[model samples]
Target: MTVAEIFPWQQVLWQQIRQPENLKRHHALLLKGRKGIGKLGFAFGLTQSVLCGQVDAAGVACGKCQDCYWFEQGLHPNFRLLEPEALSAPGGAAGKENEEGRVEAAGTKSGKKPSQQITIAQIRSLDDFIYLSAHQARDKVVLIHPAEAMNTAAANALLKKLEEPPEGVLFILVAHGASLIPATVLSRCRQIAMPAPEHKLARDWLVRQGITDPDFRLAISGFSPLLALQHDEQQSAPHADFIQSLCVPEKFDPIGLAEKLHKQDLSSVTSWLQKWCYDLMSSRISGRVRYHLQQADSIKRQAALMNPVAVGFMWRNLAASQQLARHPLNSRLFLEELFLTYGELIRPVGSETR
Candidate 1:
């Protein structure tokens, strides 16, 4: 599918993609953004746009052409899509287990598990693919999703290719955080920053999808429409109620709240916390609040009582808690510490004296 078909917001980016003048000197392009924002989709569309033998005046691929048809069927020799094999999910066959175990063992020797890191074997295979002649199109396109999954060695190996890439080849690296990549990799490609959609735009998109809840909009303001939909379904009902309770300090229980959150997915939990903070900042600044506005009074009260630096420190702690959640840890204790720290940060300084 075309970029426009994948994401309506991509029209702006597609305009630039269509301009031949804009394409010069950037054979390797990095598209960096959070997950579920259609970065991979965009990269795929750009691949088709570049490789399509027939193109319309609007610069969109003619989907009916042989090249597009092959691409649609995953038979196109010119297009390569690579992702971590761990993403395939676990269980099923013994053979599958053996294969995965071997890959994982190889990965571990290289300092990371296969599920955690894309191995050097995977990166080396790209060289063979890129060196071969394209079957139909003028260029060969390689799209690497979550490129940060490459281990240090794998990343370095890929860097050598990026430094002196073959002619008529394009490398598209999709990353959630560009900071994870080496400076050499960062310097080799054109960087495209894809920020989250505007709140109103996200809300409108959600409404079109039949989700009209104000709470849902508040919970996912800065996320893409796809992620908002997922969160609306996956975020626990109790979690929703708990977030609402932030408005009423009497209902807040640091340990109990932490216990609840510890059961949820790390990415979703961190996303919710980030969006909540963004909403709090909006309430503090614009007085035009969306979700969790009932907590506005408490938020403002605490904001006034605490030093601004201390408040910033609390945010930093929240981010750290989220990051720490990524690795293996005692979820209960970790979350308890996080919420207790939050409670301490929000409590009035002189309440003990009273």
Candidate 2:
């Protein structure tokens, strides 16, 4: 069996932490970083290594071992993974949990939309895993991904466990927004600030994955390699359409665009608008475009004719929109309102000649 690969950028960190002594010192690890930087993959790699029946001198999992087999099959008696039910749903966040690549969660077999927030029931269900003796008397590992997704009740429930952690059990919490997690919970874990790769490094990694126009994807993904890959595979068309419409603000039909995008993830759609406005503000003030390098010319033109103060306000307003995007009462109405507001920010290309 081949050991799953960790991202190249993580090699240094992996080397430093893979030592058995390092892992033995911590009962819980909080792996925090920007979205799509592969925190989940790192956590899984660490878990596999720790549970492997045979580990190398470098403390890497021997995938050929029985424990590795169990892990790959998702039937490891000693391992449990906790994540929002939404993530397990079709077309949902997957490993893309935060701003860069959140997808709308689909409904479960019961036709109910899977929840985006981790519930208290999930935390409570861990009782057996946390209290019961580990299989074969080995260490038990419980991994909660995007720990911030836990609601207040869930968080409080987990806090009780963290406060008096049982021996031989390891809790690994992965979070994109660690600040959203409770301070009391954070204090109980060994926090690790996961690293994002440099531009060149991330670009190189994307290239190796056969991504074309890697830089554009990388920039739009907030420089996260995993999110960049996700954009290439899943989001390319909708994103391009959204940008093209924005490029021609005069021809932009908010209702039409909203109609087209309402079926998509509200959070993701809002994020695109947020990034576009960010570029607009950035262009107007500093003559720079951050996310939309391909649309620099259009952004520059639009920025020149817009009010920097108004754009600044609009950009800030979108932050609130992001929060609302999660559970909007009417997605179409929400988007229509969003685009209509953007339409007000930009005058037609030739409306005012310099």
Candidate 3:
């Protein structure tokens, strides 16, 4: 999407970035925001617009221009997108149009896993790309998404470039967590804080995307409209079942629930469970739930009967579990343990049975 076609919430920010005169003042730009807020997308849009041979008054690329065509086809010589090998795959968001160097299709070494980090090799290759003048005589643009994915070596290599950036070169780093970036690297860039839109604006945007109960989806996504739409389409059913199980103590079926969720994505399940537990604490003390607004009433009712201290303890456990969620030896067993713990916490006020 072009800057002109960006989300309503992003228009103001885009305008600040779209001005070529304004862009020349900074060599490195950090687009930092929470997940699902389209930080990477905004960075890409601005990159395209800036590199376009022709642009509208809003600094939107004209699809008819040569540079714009090269960008859309992922063949722009002066443009480089550095991301995990997976995201740069032919079908990946980084460059779905690129048929070469697709990580999944490229395969990995024996007993070695495909790396998700931006490697030093990838960073070093830019030495050639950046040293040369722009093919379009505009600017050499390097986009690194989720810059936190870079390990120490890769970050150090990138830091060198940031420290001595070539003229007419722009480095755009899209990070969801700014703290993950090296202090040396972060100090050299211009930080742009991307805030989430207001509740009504987020909900209305979700509605425009064809989501029913926009507020519910918005709440589930932490008010990120893009994530709300994505979750509603991809994960609504499983998420609903999981949330419902936690909200109603009587409906708690630990074994069956564990088996049901065991086959799902363990990481996502872990996040959902953590959010559910967090809401329990929120409901107990604050009479509100942040992530699951739809379940606030039920959460509050259950929270009233539960011990707040116990709820707080469970929340911490869930948070720790999230750290190692992807490395579970057995998903079903892990879920069983989690559900069992939750079952004990929510056991009826007087009964001993789970």
- Cα lDDT of all candidates, in order? 0.66, 0.86, 0.78
Off by over 4 Å in 1: 1-6, 21-25, 33-36, 73-75, 88-114, 195-200, 218-223, 259-262, 274-295, 327-329
Ten-residue stretch with the least lDDT total in model 2: 94-103
lDDT of 1 at 69: 86
lDDT per residue for candidate 2 within 193-223, as digits (tens), equals: 9989999999999899889888988899889
Q: Which ten residues in a row have the lowest lDDT in candidate 3?
A: 96-105
Q: 64 in model 1: Cα distance from truth in Å?
A: 3.4
* lDDT-sorted candidate list, best first: 2, 3, 1
Better of 1 and 3 by lDDT: 3
**RMSD (Cα, Å) of candidate 3?**
4.0
> Which is the better candidate, 2 or 3, if ranked by lDDT?
2
| Residue range 100-132, candidate 1, lDDT tens digits | 012122333455444656678888988778887
lDDT of 1: 0.66
Candidate 2 deviant stretches above 4 angstroms: 1-5, 94-103, 232-235, 253-256, 259-266, 323-333, 348-354
TM-score of 2: 0.89
Clashes of 2: 0
